[model samples]
Target: MHAPALALGALFSATAAIAHLACIAIGAPAYRVMGAGERMARAAQAGRLQPALVTLAVAAMLSAWAGYAVSGAGVVGPWPFTRPALVLITVLYLARGLAFALLKPLFPGNSATFWWISSGLCLLIGLVHLYGLLAAP
Candidate 1:
């Protein structure tokens, strides 16, 4: 009925950490799996993507904790910030996911289909997280 706080949180957390690690040293082949286009691949080749992805990974870790807290598992003492924060996080994620697909000018060189599918997955993840957050007792 609700989110698997421990499991899903771990999933998110591990995903972030590993993605960061991949960016740290795996190079362009990894970015290819992430659907990076020519320009992005250039960036990776030039070694610009790693720092950016690593920075994002830090935020992703925070998001994982937010997901856990909103699930009502491992919630810290009586904080009033959970509901609104989760709402905002969910909205932002949904926006980011959907916008990537709809905005034609974005991520030039990558196939629209890839971005669309990836964005759809992001939206699905966000929605599932929202469902658990809203369902929390």
Candidate 2:
């Protein structure tokens, strides 16, 4: 199995998931630092559920993506539709990274730093996943 690249991709996704969960636990400051916008931070500070709920949903999806990567790597038992799932995940990350420039207007609340860092990370992870999948026997 093509283990290395997929393993790295899994690691990246899992780390991001953990970070998202941490933002929820850490509250307003975390939200702001993560470029989640002042509105989200205010909602978090106000004890509204929206920020936490949205963060949780994102974290859960990231975790699932990590699991798919691990499954593709043969690091665990095969998950259902592992190959297809990996392809989709790869495409998702790549698309997100590549489209970030055009999508800036759509996400005006997020900081430029956030966009740069996130886009770079997504591109890296997407490339790793692509390499792993392509190298698979």
Q: lDDT per model, in order?
A: 0.60, 0.94
What is candidate 1's lDDT per residue for 74-118, written digit by digit as tens?
A: 434434565665666567657867788466576577766658766
Clashing pairs in 2: none
TM-score of each: 0.68, 0.97
- Which parts of model 2 have CA positions greater than 4 angstroms off? none
Q: Please give the RMSD to the true structure for each candidate, in Å.
A: 3.7, 0.9
lDDT of 2 by residue, 1-137 (tens): 49999999999999999999999999999999998888899999999999999999999999999999999988899999999999999999999889998988887888898899889999999999999999999
lDDT for 51 in candidate 2 is 94
Off by over 4 Å in 1: 1-10, 13-17, 49-72, 75-80
